[model samples]
Target chain A: MELQEKLKILADSAKYDASCSSSGSNRKSGSGVGNTAIAGICHSFASDGRCISLLKILLTNCCIFDCKYCLNRKSNNIKRAIFTPEEICTLTLNFYRRNYIEGLFLSSGIIKNPDYTMELLIKTIFLLRNKYHFNGYIHAKAIPGASPKLLKKLGLLVDRLSANIELPTENGLKLLAPNKESKNVSQIMEYVKINQSKKYVPAGQSTQMIIGATKETDLQIMSKSANLYNQYHLKRVFYSAYVPINKDNLLPSLEHPPLIRENRLYQADWLLRYYNFKVTDLLDVKNPNFNILIDPKADWALRHLEEFPKEINTCSYNELLKIPGIGVKSARRIISSRRNFTIHLEDLKRMGVVLKRAKYFILCNGKYITNKEFFNKKFIERNVMLEERSLIPTNKEQLRLF
Target chain B: MNNIYIYDGDFISLLNIILYLLKNNLHPENIKTDVYHPSLFENTIYLSILKNEKIIDQIISAFGQYAMRSMYYVFLSKEENKELILYYFFQNALKRRHKIMYYHNLKCVSEVLRISNYVRHETHKMKGFLRFKELEKNILYAEMEPTNNILFLVSCHFVNRLKNEFWVIKDNKRKIISIYDKKQFVIVKEEEFKLSQKESKGEQNIEFLWRIFYKTIGIKERRNERCRMNFMPKKYWKYITEVKEEL
Candidate 1:
């Protein structure tokens, strides 16, 4: 088959894997044909809003395992092609010279066997770096169940490595990707983490979790992610919203895409990483899911109104960050601006602080500004919920309010 | 009166003349002449020859200390409203020893500074954004006509990144290449240069592959037109092979 035909099949197959970032690599231009920049280049954005920085393709679209979510599942009827190691190397160098892409993102299905697929992927990277002198970013997927020796060798050559968890829970994995086990995936992640700390995988490791595929609650997902972060030291835990392509009796046939939920999860993820908020703090067993009407931060603040009326003058950086509208940038600005002069309500507004939401929780100088009559915990909660619902009247909000 | 101080359209010579006027505490309006006929100014005056290195150094130092650093570039670009900038510089320069320094706070000065800074940042960003594809001639050709003076800044990055390989950064607008030899650099005007041979089937095939790769990788479900445009502007679409192929 022609190289273009192989690229189209492989690239199309690999598009669903959301780990195509060319960032975090410090590989400078050596006496080589290509160079890698720290700020990962985005060659283009796909229709899915993800940036395509690398020539993301698969070694082969032919798979032994039939993962239900994957387009290359054994049962699915799609034309398949595999590129030779030499073909991939030649294409990479040609593309690199033309300024088409910064690097290559190579991921493959279980072609023949895991070890066979792993060997082919490793050979491609080796050829690119050694023979082709391509120093650009190379992100290779660690095929699950590949030997420890193969995985280690793969880690050294590529800038970043990933093993998709595929699904959040063990049951989810069992249902969707029965051949893959959650423990084996986590074990590989643990290996990647240890190597990364010892300067093995300098770009670090990331894994993807398929959201809404299983009946797992948001709390469960967050707790799992927190455990993954703590235990494995994974750089990122990507949450891909499950899009049912294959007709299965087990899965629900949703009319609309779960984009809003996916967006909310990303917001929740940001709160966990940057906002210094815990998963349990964001949601509990009783309220096990995110309130889609408002963002995770706003929802949390509204629930805990007693923490509010925070003094802008005296509040610590941490205290200021806890407010809904105050992000890292705004929080730093507030800290710096306060040193020059005492801040007022209007001053915050001028600094681009969202006073509409912040007004209820904060005080200019030990004074309640927004609706003093609703200063109590219940009244504040009610008012905030009303405000949230007014903004976005979700079905859940409609049912609760009525 | 909107008095224009026209230079000989040469950067270094214009810099030297501006330094001479600045050292004498003379505003642009005070002296001018018709050096170059069609672009001549009636009030222009030819600056006296100051061959002494020390005096030249003092004048350049004063220019740096008094004149708005970036406004000089704007002035060289022959942008409109050059007199107001010169007027503001003179007014500020006369108030203090380096009074023109105060005019650095003017809106035009800030705009120039902002533009220069943006250009510098974008050039740095392009160092990462640049994707070089090899041609049949073994020439590692990559064309980038950035929105700023990114050619110089990007050249520094390319020099370090491709230390082993000789390459050129062709500015499509200026038709100049910042070509680097082993240890030295020179700008070559390649007005007649075509990027690829018109009949090169290999180049056309590669272009086809790039377009396929670009189109196939983009996820149809999550298309953010704004974010896409923000990173890869439409103006740059002409130079980008993949984008051009798609169009």
Candidate 2:
């Protein structure tokens, strides 16, 4: 097959993966072809709202496993093409010089076997590093059940490694992808965590689970993510809303990807990483899903209204962060700015805190300036939901942690 | 005492002006700095801040190297009050002795931070948004008109990434260009050039495939122009390879 044809098939197959970040690696240029900036860089955003940072393509579209939610499942008859290690290196160098991508994001179906596919991936990275002298950021998928020896060697070469947990629960895995196991994903994550100090996956490990694919509740997914984060020390847990690509018995045939749910999960994920929200603080078994009407932080604040009317002047940084609209940066600003000035509602506005949501939750100089009806749950929900409905977000960067 | 001072807008010159102001114990409000804007008044001292090594060392030690570099970036911004902002920050820094950089609540410190943020953010954005075309003589060329005076700030990043490749980044708006001859970037005023082969046939082939790949990957179900505009603003869309086809 021609190279263009092969790239189309491979890139089409790989697009479903949705991990388009070339971040976290501070690999500087030192007699090398490229550099990885610390915070990462997004080269382009596709019309689908996905980032095109790296050349996120598969080695080949051929697979041995038939994961039901996947586009390149073994049963589906699709075009398959494999790029040689030399081809991979040549393409990456060409693209890097042309400023087309940050680096390579090499993923593939289980070609023949896990070990065989991993060998091809490892060889490509080895050639790119040793022969081409490319020092750009590379985020490669760790083939599940690949030997720890190969995994360790490959881990050293790439900036970041991931073994996607595909589904949140063991039962979800069993139902959708019978051949794959959640344990297999965690094992590699555990391996990467152990080698973090040794510079194995220096950008740290990340994983993804397809939301809305399984019957698992939002609470279950969050708990699972919390367990994965706590146990494996993963840097990010991406939640890809299950974009139905197949007509299978196990898959959910939906008209659209659950983008709003995905966004909410991203918000919740942000809260977990940045804010002091534990998984339990956001939701419980009784409330399995987030209230889609408002954001996770506002939902949490409204539920715990007794905690509202907190004085901004005397509140701790942690307390400031818990309020609906105060993010990490703004909270720190509040802390530093309040040290010099007696903060009022006017001062809070200057600090870039979301005064619309925060007005319901905070007090400045013993004054609650917002409407008195804000004390009621329905009224608060209506106001907050109205604000959310109006927020037609101009841009949300594609290389998001969630 | 109200003799207005003019300055060429570089950090070294700005520092020299500050050094003279400090030595004279004159308030900075009596002075002004602009990048060669013609002054209406006569007898005004065009601030001749020279590259004196001894004073450079003194300035470095006084503000710390990070602050000096940051002040340079902040000055590069389109801030009208940049001179006054940097002056007040320096005045406070010299007074408090290094405590002023961390004093974010101060108006001078916050204003400096805001200007630095603009320069820093644009430099980072240019790192990604820049699109290079394969030209003749084995040269790579990327043309942009960034919002800030960010060409010099972002040059080092590209040089590091494409170390062994000869390339040039042209800032169409500022009429300045940086030429990287596989080692270091040498920025010059923008110059005109013709395409060597107009468009190499091989280059066209690769460009064709790139345009195709860019189109195929966007999931039609999840199309959001607002989100895309947020990342790759409309200003950059004219030159970006894949998105250009749509326009």
Candidate 3:
């Protein structure tokens, strides 16, 4: 096949894997072609609005496993192409030099088996590192059931290693993808955690799970992600809203991807990582799914009403972060600014605080910024919903006359 | 009438003005650079450029390195009335020591921090958005029109990463170019150095492959042009090869 045709096929197949971050690696260049930045650089953005940080492509689209949720399942009739190690290296080098990409994100189908596919990935990355002296960031997927020796070698070569826990629940995995087991994904995470002393995966490992594919609730997903973070010390857990590409009796057919729900999950994930919120704090038995009208953070604040009207001047950094709109940067700003000057209502606006939502939850100098019914839960909820009304889909049928 | 001092718009010149103001205890009505539009109300005084290195060392010693760095960032910003803002910031920094930066409630302190943050943000964005095309003799050249004077900040990052390669970064907005010779880099005005327009052979082929990869990588079912614009703004789409087709 032609090179362009092969690239098209491989890139199309690999677009579903959502891990695009090139952060956490500060690999310095030593008489090499490139280096990694600590904060990472995004070279471009795809039309889908996803960051095009790396040259995300697969080695080949030929798979031995038939996972029903995947576009590259064995039963699907689609074009398949494999890239030679030389082609992969040339692509990465040219892309990096031209400043089109920060690095390479190489994923592949199980060509013959798990081990063989991993070896192909390793050989390509090893050639890039040794022959071309391309010291840029490289993130590679760890093939489940691959030999430990192969996994270790792959780990040492790349900056980051990821093994996606494809489904939120083990039963979902068993039902949708019978060939794949959650145990294999956990094993890779455990391997990275245990082998940290060897400097394996310097940027650390991350896992991803598909949302809206099965009958799992948001509570279950958060609990699973919390457990994963506690046990494996994973750097991140990506939540991909399921986009149905193949028709199957088991899969849920939807008009659109659950983008709003996916966005809520990401917001909750941020609260977990930065805001120090727990799974139980955000959800309970009665409200398992997030309210589509309001964001996860605001929803949490409304539920815990007694915590409202936090004094901005005297509140701790942790307390400030729990307010609906006070993010990490603004919270830190408030802490530093309050040390020298008394924080007034006007000062909060200058500190980058989102006063639209924060005014309801916080008090400046022990007085409310506005005298609304902040203590009433329903009033606050209605105002927040009004603010987020743009996100709601408008009725096209009513507007047809215009 | 109050006095409004004007000097040549340069970092060292600004530092010298700050030092002179500090030593004399003269609270001028305003301080502006040569680019200032003269007004009939205030008395205008043109200050000569003084070559002094002690002012830099003095500011660094008094305010600490972090403050000096942020002050430099503020100097690089294209904010209007920056000189007056800097004067107020320096006066406050002298009194409050290093803690003045944390006093975000003060108008001058917040303005200084805000302008510095703006410059820093532009520098970081240029690090990602600037696209290098291979020139003749294997020299890489990139052209950008960043909002702030960030050629020096962005070039420093590239010097460490691409240490083995010869490269040039041109800021079209400021008309300055940073040329790296695999060991050291020199920043010169655009008139002092000229770059060839000829591209290296097969550069087009690599760019073509990149465009193809960029086109195919996006999911057809989830195309959100608004979201794409949010991250990579339309203003930056002019130079990026992947989205250049739309331009």
Candidate 4:
């Protein structure tokens, strides 16, 4: 096949993998041709609002394993094209020079075997860095069943690496991706983490978990993510909402992805990492999923109302951040403004804090500003629900499911 | 009454005029003109004075002594509030001392520096955000008329990123234009300029691609209308390749 034809086929096949980000590294060009910008280069945003920087493509679409949900799975008959190491290197350089892409995001199916495919992938990156001197960002996928030594060596060259935990739970993996094991995936992640700490992967590691594919609750998924963050020091844990492309009995037959669920999970994940909220804080066994109506932080604050009315004047930075509507910037502003003078309720309004949600949780000068008569739980819940309904346009299709 | 001073719309010529007016210990009521106006004019000075390169050099030197070479560009760009600059130049010329220009706490000097920084940062960020679409004859056209003198700064980013590509960045508000050759750049006053017929094809394709990409990427379930609107404002949609098609 022609090289352009191969590129089109490979890039199209690889587009479904929602892990195209050129961020998290601070690598600068040292008498080199290309430099990596710290803020990240978002070349384009795909139809799904995901940032596309790299020319994301698979080495080949041919796969040995018949992962039921994947378009490129073994059972699914599709045209496959594989780029040799030299072809891949030349394409990257040409694309980089033309300013079409920032780097290369190369992934592949287990073509022939995992080790053989990984070796080819590693050779392409090696040639790009050493022979071509392409110092721009390169994010290569860690083939799950590849050897530890190959994974370690590849980590040294690439900016970021990801071993996709395609499904949430072991059962999901068994039912959908029968050949893949949850344990093996986690072990690869662990190996990547160990190598990253030893300075092999300077950009750190990230993983993706497909949500709503199986019956796994948000709590279970978040627990796994929390553990991954704590254990491997993963840079990020991306959640992809499963869009059923293949007709499979094992997978849920959905017309569209559970986007709200995906969004809620991101919100919940944000609360965990930045807001200092725990997984348990977001959901318990009874409430294993996020409340779609209110944001995770607001939902938590509403449930734990006794923690409200903390004095903004004297509240520590950490304590101020715990408030639902207040973020790091507002928390810092509250701290800075208070140093100059006693902060009043009106002052907070001017500084751009959400008074409606904040008023329920904070005190301006030893006094709460929430409507005293309408300060009951039912009243607050009704108002919060009203606000949520106004915010989310009530996509009738999504609303129909409930 | 604050009178308006008009120049020939040449930046270097205006700098010389501002210096001459300041050296002669004359303060205009207000500098006003659709023509090129430099900073450091408190009062209006009409373009009655002949263009003098000698006077311009003296002013450039005055700015240079304080390592404020870029300040004159800001001045030429018509960044506001130059009354203190007028006072500083007048004071320094009278005393025959260059130290006054370097003197700290001069409100005009500080304001110019602050605005310069603001303009520079905004221009850099806009470089990343300014979406350019291909036109018919391979002309990359992007329209951004920012509130500040960010045109020159943004051009540098485009020039560096798109080295071999020929592109035009037009400021729709000022009608100022920056055209890039392979290596050189020229800023021209375009009273009325339209995208070439050849360039229109690239624009259409880019618009189509951007719209399709933007629609596909955003997860409907996680749509934060407020956040989305806040980051990508409707006002900017006219310049955005993707959002324009949807509109």
Find the candidate with the highest TM-score and give its number.
Answer: 3
Cα interface RMSD of each candidate: 4.8, 1.9, 0.9, 7.0
Predicted candidate 4 versus true structure: per-residue lDDT over A1-402, tens digit per residue: 877667767776777787777877766654344666666676544444566578788998899999988879988878888988898887676555434457888899898898999998999899999987777888999998888889888998899898888877778889988899877778888887766753477677888888887899999999988988998888888998887778878888776677778888988888878888889888899998888877888888888888776898898988898887798777877776676568777767655588877777788788878666665668777778778776665665358756
lDDT of 1 by residue, B1-247 (tens): 4334555544445545555666676566532323444335344445555444353345345556324445444443333444344445434444444433323224443445444445555665566456454555554667776765456667777676666665667877667778776465566678644456233337777877888887888766555666677676677766666666545
Q: A296-379, model 1: which lDDT tens digit per residue?
A: 887888788778779988899999989977888778767866764677776676555788777778888777787687767676
**Per-model lDDT:** 0.71, 0.81, 0.88, 0.71
**Where in model 1 is the C-alpha error above 4 Å?**
A197-199, A309-313, A340-402, B1-117, B124-136, B142-145, B163-166, B173-176, B182-201, B223-227, B245-247
Q: Report RMSD for candidate 2.
A: 3.9
Model 4 Cα shift for residue A145 (angstroms): 1.6
Interface RMSD of 4: 7.0
**Winner on lDDT (1 vs 2):** 2
List candidate 3 segments past 4 Å from native: A372-374, A391-402, B35-37, B48-50
The C-alpha TM-scores of every prediction are 0.78, 0.91, 0.97, 0.75
- What is each candidate's fraction of native interface contacts (fnat)? 0.56, 0.60, 0.82, 0.08
Q: Is the docking of candidate 1 incorrect, acceptable, medium or high quality?
A: acceptable
Q: Order of candidates by TM-score, top first?
A: 3, 2, 1, 4
Scoring only the A-chain of each prediction against the true A-chain gives TM-scores of 0.90, 0.95, 0.96, 0.94
Clashing pairs in 2: none
Q: Can you give the lDDT of residue A10 in candidate 2? A: 80
